[model samples]
Target chain A: MLNKVVIFGVGLIGGSFARSLRKAGAVREIVGVGRSATSMARAKELGIIDAIGVSGAAADGALPLADALHGADLVLLAAPVAQTEAILASIAPHLQAGTVVTDAGSTKSDVVASARRALGSKVAQFVPGHPIAGRETNGPDAAIDNLYVGKKVVLTALAENSETDVERVAAAWRACDAIIHRLTPEEHDKVFAAVSHLPHLLAYALVDDIARKPHADLLFQYAASGFRDFTRIAGSSPEMWRDISLANQPALLAELDAYMAQLTVLRAQLAANDGAGLEQVYSNAQHARHQWITAIEAAETPPSPDKAD
Target chain B: MLNKVVIFGVGLIGGSFARSLRKAGAVREIVGVGRSATSMARAKELGIIDAIGVSGAAADGALPLADALHGADLVLLAAPVAQTEAILASIAPHLQAGTVVTDAGSTKSDVVASARRALGSKVAQFVPGHPIAGRETNGPDAAIDNLYVGKKVVLTALAENSETDVERVAAAWRACDAIIHRLTPEEHDKVFAAVSHLPHLLAYALVDDIARKPHADLLFQYAASGFRDFTRIAGSSPEMWRDISLANQPALLAELDAYMAQLTVLRAQLAANDGAGLEQVYSNAQHARHQWITAIEAAETPPSPDKAD
Candidate 1:
């Protein structure tokens, strides 16, 4: 069991991770750290953390980090992507040798770079990780012990990271019932940029475009369940998404270009009134989507022991 | 009450309309028509219609139009976009002089054009209508009596349509508890193209793009609920959407261009690492979506009679 764990962002992800670990009996004392004292205190009251550490804007490393880091076995940086580097630097001096550091940031390459810059030689203990799980809700109140159950936790271990440190981080996630997969920071960034970040950006853009229309109220009135589902991600946390967009810019821009090319071809077909061409594109998408859904359902279904034999 | 109502297509929209009318006791007799005899027969068996008329491929007007059209007070052309004109033309030769004709086609301008071409002088009796309601599931089996209840039915009344004909169609939808709204065909097309059609096309394109990736299965495995909701429309009927994309090309292209412009600006912000700019866009979208949802909920909430007084 971990002696003590410090989570430097007591939001939904961090709080959920703490809850999961508590349930798994994987950690002893859990300390929640954040800029908001009220929220951190509330998190403590909600049993999301064993104690609360309010780290106010003292950038000189005088925020009683020693107490929080004393005998700490793990440090989870679950702050916004933009704040990861600062948090890393602040805690680098206090973390004991062999203490594993990890993060739940959406984008990885930037976070990995931040760990390298902030920790220097201590980066050997840093294993950048992202759990592909979240709800539209926020804060400690939204935390649940089972949020990471059956979820995917992607680890982009730095070249400097020791195998033991990486394994420790992976073990923590597995304790939370999350399956761990490793990839290069670049590969993780690219894959999520296409599947997650780009889709969120597109959703935000679509909703913004529609909201700006002259007849927006009328348009929205006619907007059915389809529009509701399509723009659901537009309701996500703006600050979090903003940090992610900037952090993974190159990969996101490349994916946007690829997507724009697809839209352009569709536009050409529509413009030419090419019914057959339109049918072909729509048919291909429909068939592919059906196949993907089928594959997902099949994977989700457990194989019977009889069938296995 | 209508003496006789003949509905072509007999799919989700058509079948739902027939079921709604039956539930409302608004029609004396409802005749279902379709290309598939089995489906039409099933629709009849399911009580979605009083009788089934299998319109065999004998486009030579040999499909006993007289019997189906005999004493018909109303006719609903609910076929696919491409088939609307043919269905309108086939029934035009037999529709009684005072018979009111309406449709549930998605694109109004195209359907209005079809009515004009098919009905000639009888176009005055045609009132193009589009009920803004549906489920992803299609066919008579998916029909629900309350599908149109509290839904908006947009009527793009043609220039040739008499006020009486328009009112007749409005009354029919009102009986099904649908609220009727009027718009010019051009305005209707533009609004829907922006809010509905463009989103559907983008969704399809995004899903198709990801499915073509070499690591598509991996990508999909990591895709969360957000991706599922965002790409839900990609699973829509290909033939139906193909027709809509082609039918509303000009408006759809315009909306697509506007959406592309928004995406391009966002891309520039990401490339420039303009966190503030990205935050502004995302914040605006999130706030707008929240407000829209609030407005929709408020609108859906029944007003107190005391407040009305």
Candidate 2:
């Protein structure tokens, strides 16, 4: 069992990891560190973390982080991707030898790059991971011990990292009953840009489009289940999505170009009243969606009862 | 206290109307007319209809339409919108003098125009309607007595329609527990094109884009809950959406153009790394979406445990 674990940003992601590790008997104590003092106190009260460590990090921090990081078995950076670099920089000076570090950021390449820039020679201690689980809810109160259960935890191993460090990170996630997958950081960013990041941008665009219309109120009155589901992701944190969109800009832009091309073709068909063409496109989508949903159902892994993590 | 009701194309919309009418003790006998003999037979077996009537409309129809229309109090055309003109034409010669006609089409202006062309002077008896109910599930088996409970049903009364005929159509839906809203055919088309048609087109475009990519299988494998909800509408009937898209082409095209413009601005912001602009758009979307969801929840009108109807 890990003697102590240090978690930065004890929101849903960090708190859940602390709770899951405790549930699995893999960690004996968890100390939380984050910008939100209220949430860290809540995390401690709920036993999600054993103590509140630091308000921030390093020379400018509210408290000394070394007291918490001295012998910590692992340090998890679960903050927004925008903070990854600074958090890594802050904790790098205090990390004990053999203390593994990993992150649960959505964009892998950016986080890997942040680790490299912050840790310098100690970057080998960082094992980059993206835990694909339910992030539909937030706050310390929303954290659940089973957040990563049956979820896919992707580990994008760096060449500088030893195999033992990677295995230790994978084993900790496995303790929470997670299945592990490996991908290069570049591949992870591209794949997620297509599926996750692009959708958020599209959803945000659609919502903003309607919200700004003169008849928006009237139109919203008639919007139903379909619109609700389509724009659900638009309700995500704007800053978080903004960071992700920029962090994965190249891949995301390529995705946007591809999607815009599809929409342009579809618009041409509609403008020409080409029923056959529209039906063909719709048919392909329906068939593919049916096949995908069927495979998902067959796997018996119901989508997280939650969204985007 | 209608003695008989004749329904054309008795699928979920027609079947639900028939069931709801019976549940409210508003109709005594129901006759179903459709191209699918199997489905019509199933409708009869399920008691969603009292009898199977004609197979199709006019001279090419499989059975006599006279018997079903002779004493009918109302005629509801619930088939795909593409069949609207033909269905109205066929029923015109046989409809009883006081028999009210209505439809459950997605697009209204096109249906209103079809009514005027087919029914001529008798168009006064044709009160066009669009039932906004749960259509996620289809066919007779999926019909529920409360399918329209607490839902909004839009009635687009034509200038030629008599006040009594319009009221009768509204009353029929009221009996099925739907709230009634009135709009001109043009207004209905424009509003729905924004809320419904545009989202379906967006969803289909997204799915088709991803499904056609070389790494599509890999991308889909990692797709989670957010992707699933965003593309759920892509699972709808291609024929229905194609017809809706064509029927409301002008308004839908306008909506599409507006969306494309929004996307262009978003792309420029991303290209320029304008974090402030990106966050502003995302914030607007999130605020609107949250407000919309909160209002919807406050109203306590749960989305049709079903989708698109």
Candidate 3:
């Protein structure tokens, strides 16, 4: 059992993790940490965490960094990607010798590097992770115990990480009913950049283009369910996405180039009025999407038992 | 009251229109026409129409073209964009003088041109329209009376179109509880290219690109709800979208260029690791989407009374 777990950035991801661990009875206490005392208090009031703490400095019944980590067995860094380094630095001196550290950042390479810089020798205990589950709504109020029940938790364990520590972090997630998958930081970043990061950027750009047009209101008025679904991700938190885009810049740029090439070919076909070419492209896409939906639905039907490392 | 209505395509759009008009008691009889006799029979059996007719050649108890339009007071051409010209030619000789003809083609300019070529002087009775409403599902089985309720129906009336013909078509759409909006054919193509056509193309292209990747299945396995929503339009009818992309080639190409420009600028920001620039774009999109959702929710709160011409 985890004696004490401290979660930094106590919003959706961190708070939900706390609730999940509590429901699993895997942890004795979850100490919520954040910059906002009001929000942390709300998290505590909502029973998302057993206590509250402030990351930078203590205030409003919050424990200081060293005190909060005095007896902690695990540290979950769930802050914005841009703040990962700073958060790691703040808590590095306070972490116990055998404590395990993991993160819920969307991008993993940068977070792993941050851990190496901040924790030095103790970085061996850091097993960088990303929980692939979320909703558009955020904050402690959006936290729920079942958020990760059937979701995938990707762990990019560095060469420096001990097998024991990796297994410890995996066990924590498994207890919360998350299926764990392993990948190198590079592979994880490249895969997610193509699938997740690129789509979010395209959604944001499309919505921004329409929003800035002279006929913005009229365009939105005539925009139907397709437009609504296509731009739904544009409604996500800008700061979070901005941090992720910058954090995974190289992989994201490669994805953007690939997407642009595909779009360029499509534009040429449209300009040439190539009906056969257009149909081939759309037909291939529809076929692939229909297949993927079938596969995904099947995968979701029965959650695989806790995966072996 | 309309004496008789004939729908040439008899699928989602045409079948839904017939059902709505029947529910409103606005027409005495509805004739369903299509290439598939079985589908037309199903539409009739489902009560979407009172009779069935076949396009191309008559068979399997299908009525001939002349017989289908024998007394059609209003003819709705809901065929695919590629078939607009041929459908118009088939019905031209059968249409009585002053009989109103309208089309549900996605691209207005091409349909208008087809009317000019096929109908000759009868082009004056043709009113080109596009109802901005549909589900991914098609066929008569998917038709619903409420599909067009609160939807926007854009009409692009050619100079040859008489004012009386325009009012007649608008009244028919209003009877189905659709709000009527008028625009020049050029304007309609440009607006729809930006808001609808480009998004569909991007979705199709993105899905195809991912499907061609080495880790396509893995990428899809981890794809979340955002991916689902963004790619929903990619599941649309390929032949229909292919026709639309080619029919509105010039305008679609222009919109594609504009979108490429926007994406290019965003790519530059990512390459430069400009967090502020990325944040600015995402923030603008999120704000615009939130505003549009609010406006749309308010607009959908109450169905505006049947619009006056």
Candidate 4:
């Protein structure tokens, strides 16, 4: 029954959140807060929000940072990770007494700590979240109206975040067509380091490695769809990935060390010309990939639909 | 027009060559020799060859070794690298004098040396060739008639392979719908190590690394298309990849070392929390990727079609 939701930094994630809310008929009014005139204009043009709430150049452009929160029941801090803490700091005093504050930042422990410090007694209403859906493409333009149509959204709750607060966060995500999952902030950072952050790091590193070769131009000539696919995430926003990587460095470095250990084993097998061992490893990896594919397919299918088919 | 062509070890590559020839209308007859009746039968069933020259089952459903050379005016060695030297030894005595003998082995310099030692003066017609196209799926059943279409085929020749012999190899590939690219055997190995072989190794390693994570099951749930694309090559036949990795070890190891250097810089950047530095590296990689995409697109566009528009 949250009638008014205020979204800070209405770029891709924020704009998509707006779309999902509109599509699901969850929030009656969406107030977007941003400094960029172009982004604000584009959000309005795309009908990503009912009207620009605060900082609006026009009556509907945007509300002032403080005014944007007046009477709002929910707040989404969907800004980039580097800005999340600062934005939370700016709006803390203005936030209504009981408004549930949540976020979509990639890393969470720091964000949660910052939210706790900034919101004080109101920390019980703050939840941190991340939706594991995005493209190499970025910004509001790249935001598909249905981006979260069937994706997983993780909400990390502190002990101070009451059951009521967590439920509200889950309900907001559900309205966006996202299936909600809960994880501890530490667990969220570690898992994402393995999956999201590490993968992008490897992609950027591999692409950069190949680009340095003397015959890099010709080598890329022979590169096919497989290479393209492996490195596609290398095209993701560097600044954003850079922030995410540093924010989650401890887990990422640990993951990298583990990866190098595996690579060392593979390298030794190749050096020894151990095709049998190589075959065993590759076969197992391939088998695991197929199993992973099957698991994803199973997860995507609803329980009844899965059995019915 | 070369009406008759002999293909040795006609599994996926050989079967594909047969079909590519049939579709291009370049060669009049294709003589296929393989170890498995299943493979030969399936190749024939798929219209890959007008006739199977020799067929019998080996341990893994591969064709019998010796019969692969019968009546091939231009014999193509498509045997596994381990078997290439032995296959050449058997074929050398029976190969018709003045017949152009070439190979489709992935690693070339070793095979070329073996061909010379086996056939002596008759090595003039022997050209080493490797077509850089394949799928994760393998055997005759996985062979696509158009697999080589719009793909690059590298030809590595020794001084003994006369211009006429090289031209004939080039002509055969042209007829098979391959874009011909020439390189020294050493050059071929190094370039593919950076672009092809290294990527495969990384793909296998990354999948293994991620698989070791606790929530590995859920980790993949967040894997978007980019992850799937990056790891597609990981699904390749372990046996084949193992052989390729081993046969091309020196070059691959060298490329791996180079890749590790790039990774080190990236890791340092992450550890140092240098967001802008990371962004620059990512942006450079992105630029390089775009350049590659543009080159590929230009190569794929038919020259006359643009004017026809």
Candidate 5:
């Protein structure tokens, strides 16, 4: 079991990690470090963390990061992507030699680079990872112990990371009931840019386009389940999406350009009144979508354990 | 109560309408008419229809449209948009003078025009309509009795329609507990093109792009809830969407162009690393989305029922 784990941002992802570790009895003495006192207090009251620690220096009512990280076994920089470097820089000096650091950032390559810049040689202890489990909700109260159960958590291992340290990180995730996959940091970023980042951008853009129209209220009134499901991701936090979009720019922009090309082809077909061509593109998409959904359902299904029953 | 109704397509929307009318005891002797005998037989077995009628002519052991339309109060063309002209043309000769014909096509302007071209003076008895309820699932087996409860259904009344005929159509929808809105056919087409048609096209394009890649399996495996929500519409029927895209070409094309312009702005922001600009767009979208969803929720909420409870 891990002892004395410190979490830099005790919001949804970090708070859920703390709760999961606690539920599994896999960690002892969880401490939260963040800039917000009210959020930390809520996390404390919710028992998501055992202590509230201030970030920079010692203070009257809070435990400083120096003291919090003194005996820590792990540190998770679960804050926004833009803050990765700064959080790492502050935590690196006091990090115990055996302490392992990781992150729950959506994009990996940028996080990996930030770790290298801030932690210097200590970057070996930082195993960059992303949990592919997300809801449109946020904050500590939204956290739950089983958030990662049956979900995929990706670890983009660095060459500098020792095998032992990487294994320790994997073991911690396993304790939370997450299935882990390994990929190079660049590969992880590209995959997510297509699957996650591009979809969000598309949803946000669609919503903004409709909302800016003079007849928006009338349009929204007529929108049915299809529009609701299609724009569901547009309800996600803007600041968070902004940081993700900017951090994964190259990969995301490439995916966006490809998607535009696809739309362009579709527009041409529409302009030409080519029902057959539109059907071809739609058929391909519908077929692949069906295959993917079926695969996911199969993977999520449990084995027949009660044949007798 | 209405007597002797005919439904041309015994699928999700058609079946749902038949079921709802039957459930409310608002119609007598619902008859199913379609090209697929198997589907019509299934509708007969499911009790969604009382009689199976042949569309084109008298057939072996089947009721012909000439017999089915005798003294029929209504004929609802709950079929694909592309079939509007042909169905109306086929049924026009057999249509009783008192019969009020309506449609459940997603697009309205084309359906209205098709009705006018086929029905001539009978166009006065043909009321153009669009029930804004849809599901990805189809066929007789997917029918439900309460499908339109509290959902919006738009009736685009023609100048040729008598006030009494329009009222009769409105009464039928009210019997199914659907809220009725009246819009001109042009307004209905434009509003839906922005809200429903555009989103569906966007979803299909995004899925086709990612699924055609060599690493499609890997990308699909990593797709989480956000991706699932965003592309849910991509799972819709290809033939149905193709018909919709072609039938509503003008309005949908305008929407598609405006959407592309929005995407171009987003791509430039990404290329320039403009986080603030992206955040501004995202924040505006998130705010409007929040407002729209909240308003929908409020509208859907029933009057402070159970103050005593």
Candidate 6:
């Protein structure tokens, strides 16, 4: 049975996985690695991991990629995208032949490419995955063990991904009670561009637009719950969004163009005082949102009123 | 000692006022008027008012606008903007000479104009007000007594407004726990156009943009808390938003133009793959949002753990 797991970049997602896995009693040990001592200390305090390691010691420990492949069963990559390629390359020589590796990166294709280039023989064992769960809050402190309980986790894998690797990755998420959705790396990027990346971009854009206005402070005050919801993602880490936008430029730009086009159409209609047209569009969107929300709620784990914690 | 209160349009705003006043024991024998039987029924169910009256009774029973409006101590016009002029015109001759006639319209100037034309002498008693609250959800069923608590209720009255009229209107809102921000009609519309109306238009535009995308379903699925928050306003009653946009057109259009310019700059930066420039904008927006939120929390009510029922 896969027991011990080493999670890189023990921040929000990584720490969350550790906590959930521990809560589910699905892991014997979790070794967390990160640069910040505070993160490492917090991870331990939160019981997110059984042990914490900083720098090289964690990198070269017994479950050191190759050694871990021998003993620790899974390696979860949650580091920043820019550092991912280097980490994959550094650990490539140490991976055990059949050891399965997975990632929780927001973007997929690049990670897949890095995996194939860094670990040739082990390419079949690497599955790229992203859990669609987060909050305006971040860090290990923000990690909620049940964050992914009913959330969708997309796994982007190539045809070459071994059945064993896919199952292992899927099993890991199932332990967290996450619903699994499978797709190709290309499909994953395109899909996320519209749903995730595009929304974040629009939010950032809207907030920026308002921020530059003279009465921005009052605007923010008058910013009802709707504005708050729309701009919440704007508060995300700039470094993360920077990488995401650049990595998925083509898809994001395409979405942006499409969004701008729709805006132009709506603007013109409003300029002409076309109430009918505006109402039709609003009704359609309202219907779509209602249906979407209903579906999501239906997919939720049966309500446990006491589960707020 | 004002015993009888007449509230026109027994919908969300009107219903909320009824509940608040009743709860505070500020008014007796409250009468509600709405064309829709369903809304009138809901108002009764919610205990919004003591009686439901047909248009004539609610509009003209309380006070005759000319000859020192007598019976109604307070009359609140809570109807749509397009209907505001006619409603005021119809009730003008009946308003008691001393009765304080106010409105809860989003756009103040137009309502003020209606007041001036409809009741030349009573114009001084006409206080145009808008409480910066209300949900995307609407109708009497959505009304709650606490809606105005901690909300900014802007009252726009001319310099000629009688002290008695202004004080009475101000006292009404204070009983409902609102912070009054007094401004002129023109200034109220201009400031709101920037802070409220423009944001709503942008949200609707974005929603329309997303709805038109090929992968709209997928895109919307990944819409995080931010997109939801931002677009929440877009789901408001079509009739209400139409009135707001049209009534506050000049200022809203100017704000829209400014936003479009900002969007164009961002689009150019994206097309050029200018990561640094993109990051700069994102960082600036993040900082602005942070500062804005901080200030809002400081100025407004504390973030409620349990939102208004």
Find the candidate with the highest DockQ and give its number. 5
True contacts kept of each: 0.80, 0.90, 0.85, 0.61, 0.91, 0.55
CA-RMSD of model 6: 4.8
lDDT of 6 by residue, A43-145 (tens): 7788887776443454423233344444567889887877788777766776676567888988998788888888886788788999888745667888878
Q: Is candidate 3 or candidate 4 better by TM-score?
A: 3
DockQ of each: 0.77, 0.83, 0.82, 0.65, 0.88, 0.51
Residue B205 shift from truth in candidate 2, angstroms: 0.7
lDDT: which is higher, 5 or 6?
5
DockQ of 1: 0.77
Model 5: per-residue lDDT, tens digit, A120-183?
Answer: 9989899999987875567889889999898788999999999898888888889999999999
DockQ ranking from best candidate downward:
5, 2, 3, 1, 4, 6
Task: State the iRMSD of every prediction, in order shown.
Answer: 1.0, 0.5, 0.7, 1.4, 0.7, 2.1
Query: Model 1, range B214-252, lDDT digits (tens) per residue?
Result: 988778777878888899899999888888888898889
- Judged by TM-score, which candidate is best? 5
* Candidate 5 structure quality by residue, lDDT tens digits, B1-309: 998889999999999999999899999899989889999999999999999888766676679878988899988898777778999998889888788998898888888888889988889998888887767678999999888999888999999999899888888998889989999999998998999889989989988999899999899989888888888898888998998888889999999999999999999998999988899889999999889889889888776867636
For model 5, the stretches where C-alpha displacement exceeds 4 angstroms are A305-309, B305-309
Q: What is the lDDT of residue B32 in candidate 6?
A: 70
Model with the higher TM-score, candidate 1 or 6: 1
Return the TM-score for each candidate structure.
Answer: 0.95, 0.94, 0.95, 0.92, 0.96, 0.88
Model 5 is docked with a DockQ of 0.88
Question: What lDDT would candidate 1 get against the real structure?
Answer: 0.86
Tell me how far the alpha carbon of residue A120 in candidate 5 is from the true structure, in angstroms, after superposition: 1.9
C-alpha lDDT score of every prediction, in listed order: 0.86, 0.89, 0.88, 0.78, 0.89, 0.76
Which digits, one per residue and each the tens of the lDDT, describe model 2 over residues B1-309?
888888988888999999999999999989999888888888988999987778345433234788878788898999888999998898888877979989999999888889889989898999989998767778889888898999999999988878988888888899999999999999999999999999999999999999999999999999999999999999999988998999999999999999999999999999999999999999999999899898999798656757748
Error of 3 at B100 (Å): 0.4
Task: Enumerate residue pairs that collide in model 3.
Answer: none
Off by over 4 Å in 4: A53-61, A301-309, B55-71, B213-215, B302-309
Q: Residue B239 error for model 6, in Å?
A: 2.4
Displacement of the residue B306 alpha carbon in candidate 3, Å? 26
